[model samples]
Target chain A: MLEARNLSVRYGSLTILDNVSFAVGDKQWVMIVGPNGAGKSTVVNAVSRGAPYTGQILLDGKDIRKYKSTELARKIGVLAQDTPVGYSFSVEEVVGLGRYAYSGGMLSSKSSGDAEFVERALELTGLKELRRQSILTLSGGEKQRTFLAQVLAQDPELLILDEPTNHLDLVFQKQTFALIKNWIEETGRSVISVVHDLSLAKAYGTHALLMHRGRLVASGEIPDVLTRENLTSVYDMDVHDWMRKMLSQWEDGQSGNLPV
Target chain B: MKKREGFSLVTYLLFTLAVLVTLIFCVCAGSVSVPVKETVSLIWRAILGAELPQSTAKAIILNVRLPRVICVGFVGASLSICGAAMQGLLRNPLADGTTLGVSSGASIGAILAIAFGVSIPGIEGGGTVVMAIVFAFLALMIILSLAYKLDYTLSTNTIILIGVIFTMFAGSIISLLVTFAGDHVKSIMFWTMGSLSGSSYGNAVTIAAAFAVCAAVLLSCARELNAFAISEDNARNIGVNVRRVKLIVLIAVSALIGVSVSIGGTIGFVGLVIPHMTRMITGPNHKKLLPASIFAGAVFLMLADLVSRVILSPLELPIGVVTSFIGSITFVYIFYSSRKGRG
Candidate 1:
């Protein structure tokens, strides 16, 4: 299980996240949904220890702050939104870096089991064919999958992703979500993802947290937190009717696109 | 895994062979034209238990050319290794020994020592070796202090700009000292233009020792440098102490460049160009790049020194001129090829 209590983040004199608290139980798939500037990414960043925040984050009932980086890496895997360019590492080499925290200071030497895990990560991410290609030559969606492969190679008990579908096409987005969903279902790992697309959140998420102005306005099961009224109130846009229609169509095996 | 290891081992063996062949050719082919048999005998006699007459052949082969060749090789390896480390630390392919202000600072120190003839207090009677080490360390200190004041992260543009400005500052001071001290002007000029004519056994030993020490220090941090090759935030996330690693690398590179400049006199472009060529052939992993660069750089300088001596026969040209001319042409070729590959 992963939990946060009274998480607050401030940059200089301005506060980005104020008193945000939430928890995801074991084997739960939680999605954080919000509009722009809602501090959704900040919450994820705080939980991952990427930024300084005044709060307590616990992994498996132990305070995460007390754990060393290698220990933390063993427990949780985090993928931030920003993807760097100009790196010349091949796909397999990049995935191999995921084993760095576990390589125990001898990064060049690999155990036979570590190699198998890296191969399995490539297979799971559907990137076995592109394993030897340089990372700089990959398309954006392929790059995202490469990062996903790296995180999966880490084999963490908890997975955290920030805007994992931003640069992906529709097909890639669906494939990626399906991959994550299947992994979580098979391994019974806890997942927390910051998502911008409400449809993706409704489709794959088991639990949802709604944020507005850096504070959580709703948190519960997907049906309870992603209702028509809550969407309208938080986004300040009238999507209630459109959401209801899309929900029904999605239920009936029809496309879920709504007119703008 | 087996294949990759085998390939890397083959490459390493080939590079070692190339370096050995180049070193022998460089030491053998000079202007004086000592016969191969006599040169080999002279070298064997010097190393083993034999008595060879001190003729012009033995003097030229053993006393003059051998030390110069050794000095050139050591300087080349040191400068190129420092360039590789600096580029990795700054996360820029264009960073070099001079980009971080080490060359300019060392040149200034050498010029001051030449013009004013000020023997430092501690090493007043220790001759040129002590003076060189002192000046080199002083230059390193200045550059590191300035970098610290400017907030450890110096952008590529800022670093280049500062390099130019500091070079000008040091050059002006040297010029002022030269105007007042008329007798030492020629020596100072020769040093500034970059020459290996003054290399001796002392210089060879000092530079070799310093290079070995500095190389070991930098190689020990290869993993940290590799983590830095990704990104600072990513490196930090993986528990690398980014600031401390940067400081150690900066000091190591500065010291390496300083020692080279003190020995070989401001030879440029090998530090900048050799690492890039190594990266092109061996990929950007520092583990391979650093060792390959050392070998490539040593061979390149050895060949350049030979050309400098033999091209003009009786009149020896400064090795710097030969290196800069060849290095620029090679740089242009590399730039064109990389662009073409991209296109």
Candidate 2:
């Protein structure tokens, strides 16, 4: 379980996230949803100890700050929203980088076990066929899957994903959610994701946290936090009826009718 | 996986062969050309501590050409390795050892030593070397801190721009010093233009040792450097201590550049050209890139030194001119090709 208590992040004079708190229990998929610049990513970043915060973030009842860099990396693997890789690395090599913490972070420190993890990750993410292909040659969906495979290879207890489906198409997005669901079923790992797709968030997330203007607007079960009134006010739009129709459309097996 | 393995193996073999051949070629072809027959045996005898022939040949081969060639090899390798590290650390393909104003800073330090006979007491050329290292690190630190303040991140563009500004500032100071230098101006010019005429056996050994130590430290962090090549945030999230890696790389590179500049006087473009050239052969993996750059750089510079020596036969060309010539040509080619690829 991961817990954040009154977390606040500021960049000099500007407050990025203010007094936000949320907790996710074991194997729970908690989706944090809000409009752009609502500090949803900041919440994920603060919990992962990627950002300095005023309040404490506890991982399994221990402050995450107390953990070593490598130790924290082993426990919590993060896949950022916009991981723009500049160099042309092979898909397999990128995935194998996930084993850095266990392998001592050296060029020759990888063991046979690390190789096995990479292979399994590639297979699980359906990237086995493209293992040797240059990542620069990958499509947007394939690249997203490549990074997801990398995170899976990390084998962390907690997975923090920022906009996990940003570059994905409809099919890859569904596959990504299915893979996360399967990972939770098998490993019982907790996941905290910043998601823009409310329908996917509501359909897949066990819990939902709504944010607005660097503050937590609501939290709890998906239905409670993603209510029509909450969605209308936080997004400042007439999204309630549209969201309801979209959710019903998804449930009715008419996913194509929903907005991307 | 198999292709990458085979490619690296072939590159290693090629670079090794090239270095050996270039070294032999460099030892043989000089103004006082050692006989082709005597060259191999002379090198072998020198290596085995056998008495060299009692002739001017021994002095030229052992005392002059050997040290100078070895020094050039080490300096070339040092520059190339530093360049690779800098490019990775800054996440900029255009970055090289001198990109952070190390060369200009070292020029100022060298000018001070030449102009006022400023020496560091114990070590020969220590004053220039120490001052060079200090100024290089100072310039780099300022750029890093300024970039950090600008966006709370060490933005690559900000660092590059600031480094260019610092380079111009150092240039103006060097020009001022040259105006007052008068008699020592030619020597200062030669120092900035770079030459191996001042190299000795001791300097060669010192530079080689520095290169080995710095290369080992850098290679140890190759995995982290690879992660950094992707992105800093990605590197941190994957458990790399980005700051520690950055600090170690900067210090090691500055030290390497410092020692090389003190010994060889700002050999231009060996750092920039060799890495891009090696990167074309070996991919961008620092693991392979660092070593490949080292060997390829050694070969490239040995060949350049050969050109510097034999181009005019009697009057030697400055090594810096040769390198910059080669470097600018390669830079233009790389730039054009990359732009073409993008379009």
Best by DockQ: 2
Q: Candidates' interface RMSDs, in order? A: 2.9, 2.3
Model 2 chain B — which ten-residue stretch has the worst lDDT?
B1-10
**How well is each residue in B207-256 modelled by candidate 2, as lDDT tens digits?**
98888888999888888888888788888887877778889988998888
Q: What TM-score, over all chains together, does every model reach?
A: 0.84, 0.93
Among all candidates shown, the one with the greatest lDDT: 2
Candidate 2 C-alpha RMSD relative to the actual structure: 3.2
Model 1, span B64-93: residue lDDT tens: 888888889889999899888877776656
DockQ of each: 0.27, 0.58
lDDT of 1 by residue, A1-260 (tens): 78899988999898889898889998888999988888999988887777799988887788987877767887888776755633476788777767666756433454457787788888888788898889878878788888788888888888888988787776666677777887887799989999987877887889999999888899989999988789999989976566555543223322221111
Against the true structure, candidate 1 has what lDDT? 0.76
Model 1 TM-score relative to the real fold:
0.84
Q: B156 in model 2: Cα distance from truth in Å?
A: 6.1
Instruction: Show the colliding residue pairs in model 2.
Output: none
Report the C-alpha lDDT of model 2 over A1-260, residue by residue, as the tens digit.
78889899999999999998788899799999999999998888787667788988888899998987778889999988767776777898889888888876455677557877888788888888898888878878788888888888899999999887787676667767777877888888988889888988887799999999899999998989998899989988877677656664334342221111
